[model samples]
Target: MSTMRDVARVAGVSAKTVSRVMNNDRYVSDDVRARVLQAVDELQYVPNVMARSFRSGQDAAIGVAVPAVTGFFGYVVEAVERIARDRGVAMYLTCLGEDPDGEQAAVEALLARNVVGLLLAPVADDQSYLKPWRERTSMVFLDRRPRKLSAAYVVHDDNGGTRLAITHLLDHGHRRIAFAGDSITVPTTARRRTTYELTLFDGGVGMDPFLVSWGAHRVPVVPRLLALPDPPTAIFSANPSCSMPIVRQLHAAGRSEIVVLGFGDFPMADALTPPVSVVEQDPTELGNQAAQRLFRRIDEPDKRLPRQVVLPVTLVRRGCCQRARMGPAA
Candidate 1:
């Protein structure tokens, strides 16, 4: 209810002085700042953020766009929110689902709010559309890099992680290994799938197209994969969404012989009957680094920072990937 003008009147200072004091301007003397603070407290004055943003041409908040606020992405959101709270800034979040077509519109909606910075986990392959807004807003890509647009990004080493998982399986003597994922269109899935094939090829076991399964949360692929004449001895799940369902299906069918290695760790992974092993990627760290890069961009709009940051991943061995049992031929 109380406005800056009211505080200024009570503090016996001009509205401009009140504004400077509220913004922590160093030019205002200590006595005047104290008087303004006392008046603000007495009147319960709350500065309107929207008004301030309108006057300054940018909001004191940041925007985040992700596929969904669940699983690994949920952890990223929590981390970013923590940093935003610590910085005394607000965050606006939007879930773009799995559709790449909707990505541009959703991002534009956030930009329309005049957000000072944006942290995006983009689904679209090409992000050249964001080029026009680059001058006004600080944009940092998270988890995936932009294709056409060169910008600051923080992402996991998908190729290295996938190699680690596939090599682990190969070390355990899993020659007949399969790849399970959401969709090949996704950048992360594509990278992991490529690495999975390359690692298998390098290990002297060429890729088997029939062994790869991908769709939108479809679990029936598991049964189909098992029904093959030559079933895979191991499967490399590209993400947690694919990992959980495949693990569930295998557990229900009592197919403990088929090994599974996931790309990202999830809850209940260690509690499964044959605890799932994974190439561990820290979503919290990814989010933290991405948020930090975004703030850096906001602070130094003209300074040239590194274009990309690739964080390393580690493999967590567990009960799933065991030495292959000798088949009848062997």
Candidate 2:
């Protein structure tokens, strides 16, 4: 148990300066801070986090309850973990598996650990679990936000990202464009579906019920759409996860004429046969922003402002977005 006095003596600084360096007070000068750290390391001195917490009253851990690691949520979680590591915050990652009950359970468990904050993608629209613990912890929702919870959040503009992909297809002279998404139960898919339909309607393209196909949350509707009398010239699968079934269906149907665009960037965007073109969400930036926002909230909880940050997305065009005038199938 090397005391602050030992560190101060070796570093030639006051005991008060040692305390400032340990607590990251940011008031100490650069040179003194460096020497203090070197001395502490040379002495193999470990600060008592429990004692520090008793004095500072901070647990220094955040609870992040993520939805299943299937599609966009999975990518978002990965980026957030990196930010967590850089911030030196302990992140307790739990999978909700898209289950409302499971999400509730996870939240309860994290709260019990005296977690200072929470980053969540609200699984259920009904935030019954949040009512009691809302004040105890600062909660930030990621990806999909709940309707009623008025707390701070970080989410991609689902409407804007989808609009970019759809607009690209429309601009490429593909009038009979179609959309494939999982059912409207999921908030993310539902928002994207709205964007796709509204974009077509705004462009004077009549709504084609036949062109819209739905599937299970994990399933793809490629086969059903391809079976239609007039298949779409361009297709926008809801997200990259949906791309697998769509591409697989295209190969199985032996149809290569239709152009395809995926919602989010694919890991192997360039390696695919046609190379996937996508509207990419910067989740790394999102995570960094989330951490920045969370710490700010923890540092100043009494502040009346609720900061909601929406990150921008970019469309990466590739060969897959190209299209040509196609004759009806034989």
Candidate 3:
């Protein structure tokens, strides 16, 4: 309940002098600054950030809008928070749960908070609604780029990584390969699926349309993929959510011999029976890069034009994807 006037009274200084000390004005004498700070500590005074922002026409916090608070985006949020802390800026986080309406509401709430910038992994198919705020807020997209906005973005090379995975399987003589992922409407999923088909063509293997499965929920179709007349010798699971289910399905059916190369590396991936190999993209690095770029844009909005960065992905060799071409054991 302590106010600036209380601190000023306790420090025997004018209200303007106390305000100068609180704002770290260089003109305040050392003696006055020390007394004002001591009075602030003794009174447990908390400055109102809203009031400060209103007066200065600036906000010290950045908003982070993500699809969810779990999985790969969870790691991204953690890294963004770490960098924001290191740079002494507040991060206001919101999760949309993969819904377009929720994404719009979350972003509007952040804008209402007077956030200086936005770091978003948007779910909306179109983001043209943000055009009005574009002139006022610095924004940097994460994981996926915005469809209608020309903002800075940081994303993984999903297509290239898919090629790496399929190429590995092809090298291991897996001509009959299956692809599993989320809906093709997702930008990453579409790119990965396209790459999967292109890789098969380049390897001189015929693409099987029946082997590719995608939808809003593709986990249930995993079991069906294995039941086909000509089941795949290997499967390339594109997203993190799709990977674990396929692994479990294979284990449940005692079909662990079938090769699996997942896109995103998960925790305990190395601890599983026939540890899951993966095309690894560092979510932490991706988030850190996004936050750093956002801050740079906030500081030099006009000096630096929008930059889109795509981080590389690598394949991790593990037992699951190491199956060699051979007949079933007698």
Which number leads on TM-score? 1
lDDT of each: 0.87, 0.74, 0.82
Which candidate wins on lDDT? Answer: 1
Error of 1 at 81 (Å): 1.1
The local lDDT score (0 to 100) that residue 65 gets in candidate 2 is 80
Off by over 4 Å in 2: 1-58, 70-75, 328-330
Residue pairs in clash, model 2: none
- Candidate 2 positional error at 216, Å: 5.8
Q: Give the TM-score (vs. native) of candidate 2.
A: 0.80
> Candidate 2 residues 1-330, lDDT tens each?
676689999999998788678767668889999999999999876554333334446576778887666566666667767655554567777777656656677778887787777888777666655778877677777777766666788888889988888888888878888888765666878899999999987777887988877772366576777777777887888876677678777767776577778777767767877777888887667766776676667645687755677788888898787754675435
- The per-residue C-alpha lDDT of model 3 at residue 197 equals 94
How many collisions per candidate? Answer: 0, 0, 0
**Residue 73 of candidate 1: its Cα lDDT?**
94
Sequence-dependent TM-score of model 3? 0.80
